[model samples]
Target chain A: MTKTTGVGRPRASGAAASKREARLAVLDAAGELFTGAGYAATTTRAIAERAGLRQASLYYHFPSKEDILAALLEDTVRPSLDVAGGLSAKLAPVGARLWALAYADIHLLGSARHNLGALYLLPEISSPRLARFRAERAELKRVYGSLVAAAGVPGELLGIRTDLVFGLVESIAIVRRDQPDLDVEAHAVEGADSVLRLAGLGEPDAGLRDSARALLED
Target chain B: MTKTTGVGRPRASGAAASKREARLAVLDAAGELFTGAGYAATTTRAIAERAGLRQASLYYHFPSKEDILAALLEDTVRPSLDVAGGLSAKLAPVGARLWALAYADIHLLGSARHNLGALYLLPEISSPRLARFRAERAELKRVYGSLVAAAGVPGELLGIRTDLVFGLVESIAIVRRDQPDLDVEAHAVEGADSVLRLAGLGEPDAGLRDSARALLED
Candidate 1:
C-alpha cells in the first residue's frame, strides 16, 4: 500500500493553484502592512503592491480593505477563542480552567502577536469596523468571564481578576513588541501564574513559587 | 491686626499684575488643550491664541513646551505620590499600606480625572518625556514594591501585586476617559478596593471593600 499526502493536489492544476497562492499572499502582505502602518494609513493598492500582484487581482480576492481586515481578525481571533472554549469545557475545577486559559492565551499571543497592534490601534482609527470587532471581543470576554465567575468568585472580584489577567497579558505583548531582547514567553507564563495565585485560583505551590522567583530574577 | 491686603504689590503695578494674570490664563488654556488634543497635537501657539496672549509672552512663564508638560505632570502626579508616600510611611501593617495606596490612588483619580487622557496617551506618543516621567515613577514603584516585598510575600508575587495595583488604577482611568457619563470616582474607588482584596488585603473587617462598594452603590 502507498502512503498518500493529506489533502492531495487540487484538480485545477496551475492556474487555480496560482490563484489560491496569490490570494493567500495578498492576505499575508495586508496583515503585515496593516499591523505596521495601521489600517487607516494602509491602502489596498499598497497591499497589492507588497504582495507582488496587480491591484485588480487583490480586489479579486478581497472586495475592500475592511474585508481583508475582517478576514485577518477572524483568522487570528477565532482559533484562540476556539481553543479557549474547548479548554474551558474540558477543565474541571477553577484552577485547572484558569491554567488552561492562561496556556491558551500564551499560545494565542505567540501566533497573533503581530496582528495585536492592528487589533487594538485599528479600532480607534476606524469606528464601524471597530464596533463589529468590539462586539465579537465582548462575547469572548463574556465567555471567559462566566468561566471565572463560576469558580465561586464574586461578580466584582471577577471583573478585577479579568482585567488583571488581560492587562498582564497585554503588557507582556507590549513588552515583547517594544523590546524583543526580553524573554517574553517566560514572562508571560510567570505573569499568568502570578495572577492566578493572586486571584486565589490556587495556592502558590513551592515549585510554582520558585519558578516565579526565577523568572523575576531573569 | 491689619490684613495687609496687597501690601506686597509690585512697584510695576498694573502691567505686572496683568502679565501675571495673563501667564496663569495661558497655563490654564494650555492645560485644556493638552487634555483635549494630547501633548504632540496641541501647539504652544494654539494655547497662546486661546488665552488671547502673544506666543512670545507664553514663553515668559514657560520656557518651552516641555516646561508646560512638566508643569502639568507635576501638578497632576505629585499630590498622589505625596499621599502614597505619606501613607506608606504611616501605615503599620503591609496590607494597610497597600490599602492606603489604593485609597490615595482613587482619590487622586477623582480629583485629577480630566488629566488622565493626557497622562495615558502622552507616554505612547512622546517616549523621551515618558522615559523621564517613568524614571520618577519607577522610584515610586520601587518604594511600593519594597513595601509589598517586605510583607513576607515572595518577590514574584510582590511584582504581580505591584503591577496589578497600578494596572487597576490605569484601567479605571482608561474606562473613565472612555465613558465620561459613568460615575468615575465611584469606579476608581471600587476598582482600587477590588484590587486590594485580590492582593490578600481583604480580610477580617472588609472595611476598604465596604467603603468602596458604598461609593459605587451610591
Candidate 2:
C-alpha cells in the first residue's frame, strides 16, 4: 500500500495482496456474524454487508454461506490438527505434548479473534454442513486418546478422559466469554494442567509446561 | 386399554391414564425428533406422526413446537434442581454431597429417556423461548458453585472448576450419543469421580458414595 507503482510485477503483487486482505476481511466478518447470529439466521447478504462487500464479491471469494461456515470451522480446528500431527516430533513426554496441544487450542478458542469454537456448540450441529469439522474433531480426539493412553490413563477411562480434555479446553472459551476480565495465560495453563491430570498424569510440572510453551511458540 | 368397564370411577381413571400416556408419548417422540433432527427441522406434523397421533391431537397435548422443546428441557433439568435443593438436607460430607449431586445430574443428562440436554446446544439457545431454561440453568450453576466451594475447591479455581463440572456432566449426553452402547451407570460414576478430581478433591469414598446415594433415595 506504500508508494505502489504501475510496474508489471508490482501491480500484480499489489492486487494479489489486496485480494488476500479482502478474503480475510470477509472471513472475519462472517465468523463474527455466524457466531453472533445463528448460522440458520445468518444469510449471505448479511455476511457480505458485514464484510463491507457486495454479495457478488463475497461469492467470488466464497461460493456459498455454507462454504463460509466450513471455512470458519476449518480455520478453528486446523491449528489443533497441525499440532496433533506434529506432537510426536517434539520428543517430549506425552504430558508435555498434550499440554502443548491443549494450550494452543485453549488460547485459540478463548481468544477474541473470532470464537469459531462456539460454532461447535450450535444445536444445528446435526446439520451436514459440519460433517467435515466433525471428522476433524474426531481426529483431534484420536490424538488426545493416544497421548492420554501414553500418559498411563487406564484403557477403560480413555473415552471419558478424552471427553474431559475436550471439556477442559472448550470450557475456556465459555469461561472467558462470560468473565471477559479473565487472565488468558493463567487460564490456559490451568486448562492444560487439568487435561494432564485428567489423563492420570500428575499435575504438570512447571518446568515441563515452560518447555511445552516454548514448543508452541516455535 | 384392556376393555375396562364404562362405570363412573373406572371410566374416569382410565381416561386420566390414557391422557397421561398420550402426553408422555408426544414428549418422547418430540424429544427424539428435536434432539435427532433438531428443533428447527422438526415439524408438528412429524412429531405427531412419530407419536402416532393426528396433528390436531398433538396440538391438543402441546400448543407449539417451541412449547414441546421447553417441556423437554424442563423435564431434563427440573429433576436436578429438585435434588440440588434437597442436597443440603442430606447431611453428607462435602465430597459425598458433591459426588451425589454430580452423579444424579449425569444420570439425568445421560439417560436415554431423552437427551434433551443436547437440545441446549442448539444455535437457537438465544431464542426468547429458551430464556426460562437459561434462567433455570443459571440457578443450577449457582447451586453447583455453592457445593463446589464447600467441597474445598479453592476460590481461584471456582469459575473454571464450576465450568468443568458443567462440561463433564453435559459431555455425558454427547458421549452417550456417540457411544450408544455405553454402560450408563459406569459412565456416570466415572464422570462424577472425574469432576471431583478436577476440583482437586480426591476420589470419593465408596461408603460415602453409598451414604450419599441413600440420601438421594430418601
Candidate 3:
C-alpha cells in the first residue's frame, strides 16, 4: 500500500508520468524552501514558483504546505525504519546490527539535499498533520532502544542510553546543516561508533565493522 | 559587555526597573510562542498579547521578532559556554571536566521552560541577526572539540569524534522536547557518561562522577 503510485487516479501513461514528475518537483521545491526559508515563511506560491508549477498545480499534488512537510519528514525516516525492521530478522550480533542501522541512518541524513531531519525541531511539526511522521520516528526510537537493550548495556539507566543513541544519530542532520563541507562517510562511522559506545558495546572493531557492512549490503 | 543590562536606556529608577521587567516579559512570551507555534508563524502582535503588553510596548523591548529569537537562542547557549569556560581552568581529570560540562549543558536544556535550544534548527536562525549566537555556539563546539582531543581519543578521526560528542550533548534538547516527563538529573548523568564514552573514556567511575559534581558545585 505504501508503495502504490496512484490507486485512484486513472490517467493515461503519459499523463501519469507527468503527474509523478510534477509531484516530485513540488516535493523538491518544498524541501528547499521549507528547510531554507523556514516552513511557515515558505508560501505555496513560492514553492510553486520554485518548482516551476502553477500554485493550483502544486496543490493538486500536495493538499497543503503541511502535507509537503509531512512528505519530506517521512522521506527522512522511512528508509531508516526499513533498515531497522530488516535488521531485526537478521542473525548478526546486536552491536553489529545497531551499527548498520546508525550508519545507514546517518548516511541518509547527510545525503539529503536539504537537512530535513533538522525540521524535526520545528514547532509546527507537533501539529496533528505530522502525527504519522512522529509515530514513525517513535517507532524507530523504540527499535534503537530494543537493540541497545539486546546489546546488554548494564545499567539502571538503560532508557537514557537508548535515548542518547537515537539522539546522537539524529544529530548528524544538525552537523550537516552547520558544516556543509563535512565528510559524510567519515562522520557516519563516528556516529555509529558513538551509538555503540553509548550502548556500552564500546568501539566498533574491524570484525564488527565488516559484519555491519555485510548486514547493510544484505 | 554581554552582561550590561542597559547602558544607554537611562530613565528614572522606577521606569528603568519596569522597562527591565517588560524586556523580560517580551523574552518569556517569545520563548513560549517561538518554541510552541514556531518562529515564522509567531508575530509581534501575538507575543504582545501573550505578554499582556501593547504591540508598541513589545517593539520598545524588542525591535523585531528576530531579535527576540536571537535573545532566546543566546539564553540557551550562554550558561553552557560559561560552564565550559570555567571547567577549562580547573585542575582535574579531562574525563571529569568533560562530564561536568555535559551535565551542566544537559541540565540547562532540560530546565528551560520551553525547548529554546530546539529553535536552533529553525531556518530563520541563519540570518545575520543570529551571527553572535552562531559564533558563540561555534566557540562552544570548539571547546568540546578541544576537550575531547585532550581526553586523548585515538585514531585519525578525532574531528569526527569531537563533532559526535558535541552533537550528542546538544541532542539532549531534542530528547527533552520529545519526552517531556523525563528525569532531568538522571539523564544528565547519562548524557555526561555518553560523552566520556564517545571520547573513549569508558563509563565514568564513581570518582569521576564525584569530581564532576564538585566541579559543577564550584
Candidate 4:
C-alpha cells in the first residue's frame, strides 16, 4: 500500500513540472514569432499554434500578446539593469565601472538579440508601447550618464556625445549577428573597450578583464 | 525667313531639353522609392507611375530595378570613397589622418543615411547582388587597415585597435540615425582624437592649424 501511494505522488509531481515547462514553452514561442514576424503581423492564435497549445491554454498563461512581449522585455531588461547596478556598486574608479557596464550590456544584447529585434521593430508598429519601453531604457541611460559625468570629464569634451551608447552597442551586435564569420566575442569586447575609452575612461585594467570574462562565460 | 527659322530651331531645342529633364525626374523618383521600400518591394511600374511616366518609358531610361539601385550606389559610393581617400592624403602623421577619416565618415553617413540603410538591408534580401557591394566595402576597410599598418605603431600597444575602430565609427553613425537629437559629428571627432591619443599618436602641433586649414581647404 505504501509503495503504491509513493508512485502516485511521483506521477502527480511530474505532471505539475510538465505544466510549468509548457508555460515557458509558450513564452519562448511567442518571442520567436514576434521577432521573426512584425508584432502587428503576429497573432495570439499563431503563437498558440506554434507552441502546440490551444489558444485558450495560451490565454491561460498570458492575458494578451502585449503581455507576452512585456514578459520578454522584463526578462531581458530587468536582469540587465540589475547586473549593471551590482557591477557599478562593486567596481571602483569611473573607468572600471564603465567597462563593466559595457560588458554587462553586450552580454544582455547577445542573449536577447531576437527579443531586441522585436523591441526595435515595436517602435514602428506601436509608438505608445515603444514610449513606455524607452522610458525604462532612459532610466538605465541616466545611470550610465552619471558614471560618465563622475569621471571628472565634461560630457561635451569627452565626446561621449550622445545618450545612445546602449543603442550603439545593440546595433553593432545586430551587424555582428548578420556576419557569422566574424569573431563576435572579440568584436564585442573590443567595441566596448573603444567606446569606454572614448568616454574618457582611462586605460583598460583587470576589472575590465574580469568583467569581460564574466559576461562571456555563458 | 531667317528669324522664323531661328524661332523654330530654338523651340525644338527647348523640347529636347524638356525631355532630358523628364528622364532625370524619373530616375529621382525611382531612387526615392527604392530607398524607402527596398529593391524587392519596389516595382518598375510603381516607379514609373510615381514619375508620371508610362511603364514602357521607364525601360527607355533604365533596364531594371537593379540598374537603378546600381546607379544610386555608384553615384554615392565613389564620392564617399574619394572623400575618405582625399582625407588620408591631406593629413600628415597617422593620428591626424585617423581623426580626419573619422570625421569624414560621420559627414558621409549624415548625408547618405538613407543610402546606408539600403546598403545595410540589401544583404538580407539579395545575397548575390550584395556580394559586389560587400566587396567594395571590404576594399574600403582594407584602405583603413593599410593606413593603420603604415602608422608604424606596434599592434601590441597604444593606438586605436585598428580592427575595432571602423566598427566603432560605423556603429555610432547607425545609432545616430535612429536618434536625431545626438550630435554625431562632434562625438565622432572627439572619439577619433581620443583613439589616436590612446594609440600613441602624440598630440598635433598648435601652430600647424594654418597648415591643417590650408590642406583641408585645398
Candidate 5:
C-alpha cells in the first residue's frame, strides 16, 4: 500500500487510486479542514486540494461539500451507536452498561485522528445533508437516556441527567481542543467515571467497573 | 430608549448613538452573526450593517471583526465571573457557592440575547484578539477550581472533575443550539444540581440552596 499524502499531488492516477481509498482520503481531509479551518471556511475545492485530488475526482466521491461534511459527522457518532447497540444485546447492570458506553464513546472521540467532534455543533451542520447523522446522534442520546433512567433518577431529573451524561463524554472534544498531548486512555477512564457520577451513581463498584471493562473489551 | 433593529438601516444618527450603545450594538450584531452564520462566514461589514452602522463607524468601535467577536465572547463569561466574585465575598458553604456559580453561569449562557456561548470553541476565536477573554475565562475556571477543591475533590480527581464541572455548565450552549424554547430557569436549576453532583457533593442541602440563592439575589 502506497502512503497517501495529505496534499500537493496532482496526478490523476493518485486520485484514481481504488475508489474505497479515495473515499476515505476525502473524508480524512474533510474532517481535518472542517475541524481546523471550520465548515463554512472550507470549500470543496480546498477539501479536494487537501485530499490531493483534482476537483472533478473529489466530486465523483462526494456530490457536495455538505455531503462530505455529513459523511464526516457520521464517522464521529456511528461508532458509539454501534457500541451501544452491541452492549444492549448482552446482560449487564445499567450503571456498568452506562460506564461501558461512555468509555467506548470517549475513547473514540479522543482517539480519532482529527477532532471531528468539534464540528458536531457547527451552525452549518444542520443542513438536510446531516439528517442521518442527526438521527444517529439522537439515537445515541436515547441510549444514554435509557441507561441514565435505569439508574433510578426521578422523572424530572432524567432529562438533565441524560443530557449531562452525554455532555460529559463529549467534553473530550473540549479537552482535546486545548490539550495537545492528551492521554486518551486515562481520559477515557476518568471521563466514563464522571458520566457515572452525573447519572447519580457515585463510584463504580470495582466489580461493576471490571464488568464494564470486560464488555468494552469484547 | 429606542429599540434597535437587527438589520436594514443606513441612518448615521442611529449608528451614532452614544459610544457605549454603538459599541454594544456592534457586539450584539457580531454575536448573532458569529453564532448563526458562523465566524468565518460573517464579515465585519455584515456585522456593521446588522447593527445599522457604516463600516467606518463599526471600525471606530471595533478595529476588526475579531475584536467584535472577542468582546462578545467576553460578554458570555464576564457576568458569571462577576457572580462568582460576589459569591466569594459572602460566607456560604462551598457546595452552595459552587451551585450558585454554576446556576449563574448557566443562566447567562442560556438567557443571553444571542447564543454567544456557541462561539466559545470556534476555530477563529484562538487569534490574539481573544487573549483577554481567554484570560478572564481561565480565571473563572480557577474560581470553579477553588470551589470544587473546597468541596473536597481529592488531588487525583481534581483536574478532570473541574473540567467536567465547567463543561457541564457550558453544555447549555449545546442545549440551546437545539432547543430554541429552552426553559432557562429550569435548566439553571437542574444544571447547577448536576454541577454539584459532578463535584462529588450530591443533593445540595435546602439551607445551602437558600444561601446560594440569597447570594445570587443580592
Candidate 6:
C-alpha cells in the first residue's frame, strides 16, 4: 500500500482538482523520501523529481520544505489527535477508553494507504518548524499517561508505562518498514490488548471491549 | 551518566593507552553529534572537532564515520549480545532469563553515559557499512522472540509481541532523549518488568527476581 490517497488518478494542471491531486502527489513523494533519508538530506528537487514535477513547480504549492512536512504531520497525526476529544478519556472505564484510543491510533497509523507513521521517526521533528506538531503529539502522550494512571499504574511508574505502551503502538511504524504486508486491523487489536496488559488490566473483558468499540465507532 | 566509560578522564594522542583513550573520546563525540544532528548530516570534521582532535588525527582512531558508528554499537550493544551466549537462555525459566537479558540490555542502554541508544535511531543504520552490527542486534532480537514464545505468546502473535517487547526495551533509548535526569538502574528494573507483563508475566515473585538477579550477576 503506497499512498492510495491519489496515487493513480489522472488530473489536469489548470483546475481545482489539479491542485488537490498535485498536493497529494507531492506528499506521497515526500513521505517516501523523508523516511528513506533524514529530513535534512532530502531535497525539494528530489521530492519534485519523485513526484514527476519540476523543482520550480514545488514552491507553487508549498512555501518551503517545512510547509510540506507540516502538511504531512497534519494529515497523519490529526487522526490520533481526533480520537479522544478535549481530554475526554477520563470519563470512561480506563481500559476500555484506552482501548478505543489505542485502536483508533493504530488503525490510522497502520493504514495501507500510506506509511505516514515513519514521519514520527524523522529527527527533524525536533526542529522549531514542527513545534506545533510536537505539542499535539505531547498532548496525545498525556492522554495515554492519564489512562495508564487511571488503570492503576503508580504515579512513579506512569511515565515509563506510558512510554512503553506508546512505543508498542508506534513500533508499528518501524515494523512497517520491513514488513509492508502487515495486517493493520489485527495489529490494532493486539496493540490495544497489550497496552491494557501493561496497565495491569490484562485482557479487556468482552463487555469492556464492546463498549470501547462502540464508543470509538460512534 | 554521560558515558561512564571515561567522561571525566583526560587524554593525549600518543601512547597505546592514550590511543585507547582517544578512541573512546571519538566515540563519545560521535555519539553526541550523531544523535544530535543525525548521522548523515554529521561530518567527520565536526566529530573530530568535538573530540578535540585534528582532522588528520581522527583516522588514527577510526578510518571512517561508519567505523566510528560501528565502534559505538560495539561499545554499547555488545553488553546485550554477550548476555545470551549461543542460545544459553534456554537453561533457565524463559521469563526469568528474559528478565536478566532485558535488565542487562536496559542497564547498558539507559546508562547516564552518552546516549548510544540513539545510535539505534540513526536512519543510516541500514547501510551496508553496518551489516555486522545489524546482524548482532538481530540475534539479540531472535533471543527476545524465542523468550516471548517460550513465555506463552501464541505463534501468530509471536512476531508482534517480540516487536512490542523489543520496542519496550529499546524505548529506553528514546525516553532518555527528553528526560536527561533518568535513573538508569531503576528504569532497567521497570523496563524488565514491563517486558514480562507484555509476555503476560506481571511482576515476578520476590524469589524469582532475586534468583534472576543472582543469575545475571554471574
Expressed as tens digits, the lDDT of each residue in B143-174 for candidate 3 is 88888888887658777888898888888889
What does the lDDT read for residue A151 in candidate 6? Answer: 91
Runs in model 5 lying further than 4 Å from the true structure: A1-17, B1-17
| Segments of candidate 4 deviating more than 4 angstroms | A1-77, A111-126, A158-160, A163-168, A181-184, A211-218, B1-76, B87-91, B113-115, B118-126, B152-163, B181-188, B194-216
Better of 4 and 6 by lDDT: 6
Clashing pairs in 4: B158-B199, B159-B199
For each candidate, what's the DockQ?
Answer: 0.14, 0.33, 0.79, 0.17, 0.61, 0.51
Q: Encode model 4's per-residue lDDT on A71-168: one tens digit a residue.
A: 66666556667867676556365666676666667656665535353244233323354445556666667777776677666755533533434544
Candidate 6, residues B94-119, lDDT tens digits: the string is 77788888888888888836777666
- Badly placed stretches (over 4 Å) of model 2 are A1-12, A121-131, A173-183, B1-19, B44-49, B52-64
Per-prediction TM-score, chain B alone: 0.73, 0.89, 0.91, 0.66, 0.91, 0.86
Worst 10 residues of 4 chain B by lDDT: B1-10
Model number with the top DockQ = 3
Estimate TM-scores for all models: 0.67, 0.84, 0.92, 0.70, 0.92, 0.87
Specify the poorest-scoring 10-residue window by lDDT in model 2 chain B: B1-10
Q: Candidate 5 at residue A190, lDDT?
A: 79
Q: Chain B of candidate 4 versus the native chain B: what TM-score? A: 0.66
Residue A144 CA displacement from its true place in model 6, Å: 1.2
Instruction: Judge candidate 5 against the unseen true structure and give its global Cα lDDT, from 0 to 1.
Output: 0.83
- In candidate 1, what are the lDDT values of residues A1-218, reduced to their tens digit? 12223266755677777787787777788777765665556789999988888999999888888778876666655665775666544525555555555545654654453535324433232346545655665566666677667656687567655654554444444444434465545555555564565455654454654443333232
Q: Give fnat, all candidates.
A: 0.06, 0.31, 0.91, 0.12, 0.60, 0.46
Candidate 1 clashing pairs?
none
Q: Model 6, A1-218: lDDT tens per residue?
A: 24345446675644767676677889888877876676778999999999888877788999799888988887766777778783374467778889998988888878836666665645566778888887887888888998899999999889877888887777777667656798888888878888898889976677987888887765
lDDT, candidate 1, at A77:
52
* Residue-by-residue lDDT tens digits, candidate 2, B1-218: 12223455545477677777678888888888776666666889998888887988888888888778887787777889999989877667777777888899888887656566656655566678868887898888888888888878789888777876776677676666566677778877887887777777766678867887887888
Q: lDDT by residue for model 5 over A113-158, one digit each (tens)? A: 8888888778876788889999999999999998988998889878
